[model samples]
Target chain A: MTQPIIRLEDISKIYGSGNTEVRALLDVNLVVEPGEYCAIMGPSGSGKSTAMNVIGCLDRPTSGRYYLDGVDVAGLSDTELAHVRNRKIGFVFQQFHLLPQLTAMENVMLPMVYAGISYNERRQRAEEALTRVGLANRLSNKPTQLSGGQQQRVAIARAIVNRPVMLLADEPTGALDSQTTQEVMAIFAELNTSGITVVMVTHEPDVARLTRRIVWFRDGQVVHSHLAPSELSQTAVFS
Target chain B: MDMLESVKMAVKTLTANKMRSTLTMLGIIIGNASVITMVGVGQGAQRYASEQFESLGPNVLFIIPGSDDARSNSFDLPRNLTLEDAEAIANQVPSVEAVAAQLQTQQNVTYRNRTANTLVLGTTPEFTTVRSFDVERGRFFTDSDVQRNTRVAALGSELAEKLFGTANPIGEQIRIRNVSFQVIAVMQEKGAFLGNNQDDTVIIPLTTMSNRVTGNTSPYGTEVTVISATARDEASVNAAQFQISNLLRLRHKVTTQDDFVVRTQKDALTIVGNVTGALTLMLAAIAGISLFVGGIGIMNIMLVSVRERTQEIGLRKAIGASRQDILVQFIIEATILAAIGGVVGTAIGIGGVTLIGATTPLKAGVSTTAVILAVGVSGTIGLFFGVFPARQAAKLDPIVALRSA
Candidate 1:
């Protein structure tokens, strides 16, 4: 009877109304247990991205109850949602959005800054996180000075530096080449194996196959869920 | 988020674009510098004027035969004040220590071959005490010389040099309107007062001037141009003025409006002070307008910055930054720009004031209140103007911002 890390009960997101009504997400229900490596698979306009935004605390569901680690966060204010995201969730974008002005270590220290952590401890933890991502030597390098693979590694380090309940990534390898994509995939796998829950959103079947489970979205609802990798081989569009 | 984090982030962001930051702060810099320097110069001008007036003499008063309205309306002052009036004041007014009656007129004089027009000052021996003029060379004329109407004159410093050319002319003769007079003494350098050259004057006995150059002291008495009086002490100046006014009114038998005016040194100082103070206020106000425009400049730049850094804002928002955090960061950045600009401008302003003080007659002083107010005002302008852009940055939609760049 353990609490789920993320629980969405009847979530809906609508844009406009009447003649121009567009339902981005319609009555979607989702549950993610702790330590689960999950992938959300869909085509364009499938509402998977909308679900990711709602789950990441970057957007509010139009209607529904969202429980994050046993807390009813659906009724929370924007500031309260920001606090939850800082303490309980991490995000990695496809473009590896590391601030150009900051070094790898400073980028990793950003989340802790919002958490009200002191400078010394933030430095130590950021160093440990960069080292964990095999970028200990690149701690002082800016994003412009790093390669795509290395930049992805820094973004990953920034993501997990705060020790969140789950890591949410949107097309984490969308901008990487095949080799760097594999490298980034290996890092995600290692993080998930070390007991950090990972939720990824991607349309590539090959990328989706790498995860432990796949939840498929069609239109604005969850159409199916796969519990095993063997079931994901039947998908199309291999990279 | 904590304040230090916001400030640190702002520093990093601003330092990344040093050129843009400096250019953005230029308006504030100019505004603050002009404000400080202009106020200092204005204050210095006031001090210079007062100093000039003080050099006239301690607790001195001038009795002129013109009312305030008449003096302001025209330059043709009535020649109603007399030598007898001055003598009466010296004898009657208890607070008056000494008096000097003058009948000043321009005359062409020849000393050997050197001929020049000179300011012939018909004054008594008490002129030396009332006007604080000293005899730099030879001896001044005595009371016996004035009583006997001796044809003698004392040249001012420059007048003596012009006529004698460094040679001793104590026993030589000079001509005033064809009347010859012996040289007595050369007066000290009194410098220029009210644009009139004191060193270009020739002092002669009042009796001699009337008898030889002017005319006889007949029906209307000896008509003097102006009467200068001094008080016994600094504190008795008002008493001396009041007593002189009453005696003149009684002697003239004035039943209605008094025809003469008694002006003190303090009265002149007050008028000069008010003029300079108003000028300072006007200059400072103009500088204040520039400061306000500087704030507008800051707002413009900050708005552009917010628009340019949309993606960065999106990324920060995605990584757990609240709207308040974003707002605080941008506002702090703007304030830092203004505060730094204020400090640098203040330094430049102080330098400007110092230069003016050293090179000019104006002793420009940098007021502490002005410095503090300038810095504080610039910082506040930054904060005030920063709000709109900061709020625009904070209100950005993360999804849209992320997709734009």
Candidate 2:
């Protein structure tokens, strides 16, 4: 059987010390299988963002065995973790995080710069990625020139351009209007249909409902896990 | 990331803020320009000094009758050198090519009521050959003229023009110190050397100058002013100096601190070279301070840039740019600024040099070595000063950077 794309066992992240201490995550165990489309849901200060950071290889767990694509990465060096993030995980932030200086095509080509892809191949791949997001005619437009939904589409294109095992997005539709939110969610669904595993963090119940699974967090620990209607009978609970 | 990409990024960022970048480069430009121009001027001064000494005659030595210290102290030199001594050196010294004894006095010269205070130089016929002065018209006096005390004079090129205007002055009669003297010839133009115009003096026979013009003021056997001698070849300059010193020491009968100082052309060249070289170094050092300040300007602007672009840094780091990549990008940006400034400064400096050359007597020239060194040094300064800011940028934590943005 194929291994889970991400496996976190007994993960804990502690900040500060003594009276000033706060636990961002505590003994949280989670698994995300390949081709799974999931959403992490919680209110403000619920540690969902911290969980997303850990899963995205952008932060280290205080104590845990975290396996990504069958390789334990919790003890990896920052550079090694960055390499994994570059090749295995793609991230999209709520701010869109597109470099203002770069064009849409160049923004999509950024990840491949670190991957040591040749310039010609990068250009070809960036064009294909932009075309895939229906931004083919707007390849040279900077982020400021594109609309909110268009910028989000460009961000999505950048995240999936490297063909990572999973795309992790935090509040991907938070800054968009309802119509644009639907458009971005449709793109996510399309990407998920193409067999790309996607994990998103959001507070909107309606946004979380579109995913196949929802992992709920409160305080600093996982409180509940819900599957889609087809697998709702197998729902799990944690206290 | 590759270096090319880093350079491209640097160019893009610099171009985005063109006004700030150019303002930052101003210091470097002025610094480089001053450095190059000062060096060129210093070199020109050295060359001018050497040319002046060269016109004094090739492989020549001067035996002055006082020590440099005594001269600097403004004490009167004893009138001890005689025409006989010059003749003795010419006849006895094996290394000597020619010797000339000269006496000088400022006297009023008049031609058709055009009275001018002119320097009157008294020397033998050998003075022309020993001093490399060519008589362009008529002829110089002979030994008989010195013996018979003929009041015949040779006009220096400028003096001749002043007294005669467009008229030929070879056979004209000019009055010197109330005595009418026949102008036997006019010497060719020899230009100016060391603020003293060689073409402004009048030459007469030594005996006539001592007996008629200056009134035999010295009681010691027709005492002359300075004795100028030329060695046969370049290699014998030091030997000639040595022989002349020994001869003068023996003849003057000195026991302590011999009454005369013998100096070769090489000695003058060295002194001038050291002085001008030191001045050049001082000028360059002062100019280097500006380059340093320019570097500080770069560092300041770059630090501000890193701060302003914290969000961009975060995005780059998130996309997998290493610390070294950021560092290289910033450093390359600074180098480009400095290099561009250096190139423009070099052009400005060369223009300044050309201007000086056109307006002055000094043959100012642009040294290629100076150009290369200036540009290279400025580039290195950019790299050196760029490090602190670049390191700060490279060491920033991506999470904090993104959060601050």
Candidate 3:
């Protein structure tokens, strides 16, 4: 019932040209409504990462219409696209790309810096974001000093620092242990419940099952879309 | 990010790699120090030479015979100066305070058993006054000695000491070219001038030196070699020289080329100034080459820094740093390095110069202008050499950079 925050229509992405051309994506259509939580599942070379990059405004689709909040993304300049990414989308990577030189609090304040917030206000907001991720005491620690799970939490804090409209995570728990992965997933689910749309890419069925809905991608096209089971017993039975 | 935060980050990055940062700054430090010290040395030399030249009175002038062509080429010796010429100048020229004519010859002087090769200077009674010579004992030749052609000579202080030892030579006789002459006075110590030892000569009456010592009867009249004159003050020296030149021209009936050269103390001072100025310029230019090489070193190190910090650059960009912000950060890092190096180098340069001054006769002067120039130039070199690496760091793609690590 809610208007879709992101829309892609008949998207096709081709690499190279002439005889050497290869279709990376063929007539793929997808929509994500505001406040929705979804996971994209696919095998190797299924074009899921490419789709994620395009969706996150890190890359442009070859020949397609990508609308973010009703604005055509293909028509925007590189700088404008970056602005869109800064204002509307937050990205969480598997490797936890936090600046090693900056403290945890300073790293979280990065997006707010780009947003042109005053220094005091940026500090206050960044502290609040870190506190929300249970890192209030670790605010002064650098990325190198934190554990893998703690660093991922810091990254999540940084991603949500500006309170972006959507969070695009690509295998966010790929580098974490099972226990830490569960903790990061719990934080993601909590953020999603607070009305921030979350789109995650994962090859693990277990990780994908944690989301509310799942979209299975095969050979550059979505083959299946369904609601995940509310209980782990039913999800295990379905798998 | 705010400027303060950017600067803080820059400083933090530099301090993180202490050895690399120090090594990078070494080039700039040596460059700045070399520039300051070399220029300071050159300036000091100039000042020392100028002060020495100033010590020689400015009102002195020398008139010597022979045209420039005859002097340069060993053609024929021109005889234009005479004792009469000196008398004429002293009487006619109002600017001329005194005129002394000199005729020189080399002879063997014997005092008892000791014999030595020495210079014999034949000059008028006024020579001592005009040349600023002081008599340590007895007195100089008088007008009566010149008129009577007295075989009397004044022993220079060193020559007297060498020949007579502790004996008083005032009223003693010394043999010059086998002819015995009475030593009327002992001239005081006068140091070296133009490589010639003024204190190693003996002064005698002009007629006695020309007739007895030199044994010359020339076709030219008197055959005086040089006419030394002095003006009342510095302001009158040029006027005295002009009058002497006109007088010589009239006496020699010269129509085109001059047969004599009039040299003044001011001319000697100008020549010394020009030579020292050229030397200072040359030294500065050679030192400037080292400074330029130091700039190249800065550029090389900055390039290496950019390569080493590639991952850091990516992280910063991913964290929302703009291209300009990255550029400014790197530039600030370079500037801090050079500024610190510049201050240290300036202090080292001043210390080096002071040390040299203390150890040698060379007077080294500290120039505030050189200090400012050294610091300013180092800062500029930082800005200049930092641009390329900063641009490279700024132009990196955030996505590709983030993926690099």
Candidate 4:
């Protein structure tokens, strides 16, 4: 097998010290191979989000060996970690955190701006990303002007604009209706099929069923893992 | 972010909240305008005073007897000015162009049945030349009039119009101190000089005024109230003043304190200059307080802006904006507000000064230094007030900020 794209060994995160200490993650050991589509599910405060944050490099694990591709994240400074996040990881949020002041295309072009791409080139790349998400015609529309499903599509366009190594999405469809949720899941599956590794956090089993594999978390540890059928139904499944 | 992008974003944000931005800028605008206008007015006053003094001719000097001694010692003072002393100075001092002695006294003049209070000046034939008096109607006193002590006088133009009405005053007799004197010439009108109305006076020969008017009761050889001297030109005024002072001291035989004071046109200009300079400085200082208040307004608005854009700051940081980028963004916002306000304020200040100058005699002078200072100071206020909010925004943690949104 090819080497895992993401490797976490004995990862743990403690919230405080001594009596007040809360272990958000405990000895979490996992590896995600290249191009894998995986889903993590847990009840509230069960540490699934915490694990996702650690994997995304948004937070540091108290004790761990986390390797993205091959480099250990524990040794990187905050600035270095930010660079890693910008260059390698893309993020999608449940609330669809598109800047209200910016148009859809501008929101998608944010990462490219930070990367110091020339203005014309950035615009070209952002337009291409929006086209991939079927939003080429709505490039000038603001987030408030778009529907819930359309906003999430813009968020996905933003996520894949830089062609990052991993797409880390936390409840990417939590706020969408059943129909919109299916639309968002279809976009995610399409991206995954195109050779992008996608790690998503969700409590909905229907959402999890769209991915190739599901890892369940309870009390800050992964409790069960299962594989879904290669051909799954696209119809809404609430439970 | 690049500077261009930051500036563009700042302008966009400010324009989005138009009313708040305008109100915020109002403070700076008013502060800048007040400072400019007040300073302009002060400068204009100084210029006006200097101009008035310049119109008085720079070579003229006044010698008033008992002026210095009257201030220090009142008992042993001598009124030692005479027509001879005036002649001696004209001959002895090479810088002196002309010297004219004058004896002044208040009297009631009767023309027909009408009577008016008027000043009587006893002077020589050279008084018209030395005092810059123009002949509006008839000629002035001649040498024959002074030598013969003729019972004749020249009426000033306003006094002529007042006492004679439409009738010609030449060859007419007017009663002065109950003595009838023939009006040989109707003198021209001279406007107010140093707050004294020159048109309200009658000029006659000095010998007639001394021997016929009041019996020359003064003990210091035909005592004169003031002696008027004119220098050859503007360049010789200082030398003329010095020479005249020395001549008068010798004539009075003063060993300790001189009996007279010589006031030059330059000395009057200096006094007016000092007063106006101090007034300008005081007005500028008072206006400076408003600028400081304007800076505080900018600070308050910036703080509010920081609070309102907290989530935006967090999002920008998450997307790779450095601390300096955040700081620069906020600072740019403040700078834009202050700079625009400064420009508008300058226009308003110029307008205000122009309006004042048009309606009143007070001049309103525009100074480039005042404009530059107002604009530069407002910009500085932006930087000063912007620092605290920019620092706070820059220090926000991206992780926490992301979590907040």
Q: Which candidate number has the best lDDT?
A: 1
Alpha-carbon lDDT of model 1: 0.89
Stretches off by above 4 angstroms in model 4 are: A1-5, A9-30, A47-66, A69-82, A215-239, B62-95, B98-133, B139-229, B234-236, B240-263, B354-363
Global fold similarity of model 2 (TM-score):
0.86
Model 1 RMSD vs true structure: 4.0
Residue A2: error of model 2 in Å?
3.0
Order by lDDT, highest first: 1, 2, 4, 3
> Which residue runs does candidate 1 get wrong by more than 4 Å?
A227-239, B55-58, B71-88, B102-124, B141-155, B158-165, B169-183, B191-226, B248-260
**TM-score of each candidate structure, all chains considered together:** 0.87, 0.86, 0.76, 0.76
Order of all candidates by TM-score, from best down to worst? 1, 2, 3, 4
lDDT of each: 0.89, 0.86, 0.83, 0.85
lDDT of 2 by residue, B269-359 (tens): 8888898888878887887787788878888988998999887777677767777777887899888888888888889988998888778
Model 2 Cα shift for residue B306 (angstroms): 1.8
Q: A28-54, model 1: which lDDT tens digit per residue?
A: 999999999899998899999999999
Candidate 1 structure quality by residue, lDDT tens digits, B243-263 = 999999998887887889888
Q: How many clashes does each candidate structure show, in the order listed?
A: 0, 0, 0, 1
Question: DockQ of each candidate's interface versus the true one?
Answer: 0.63, 0.40, 0.28, 0.33
Better model by TM-score, 2 or 3? 2
Where does model 3 sit among the CAPRI classes? acceptable
Residue B233 CA displacement from its true place in model 3, Å: 3.9
TM-score of chain B of 4: 0.73
Task: Give the 10-residue window scoring lowest on summed lDDT in candidate 1 chain B.
Answer: B214-223
Output the chain A TM-score of model 3: 0.95
DockQ of 2: 0.40
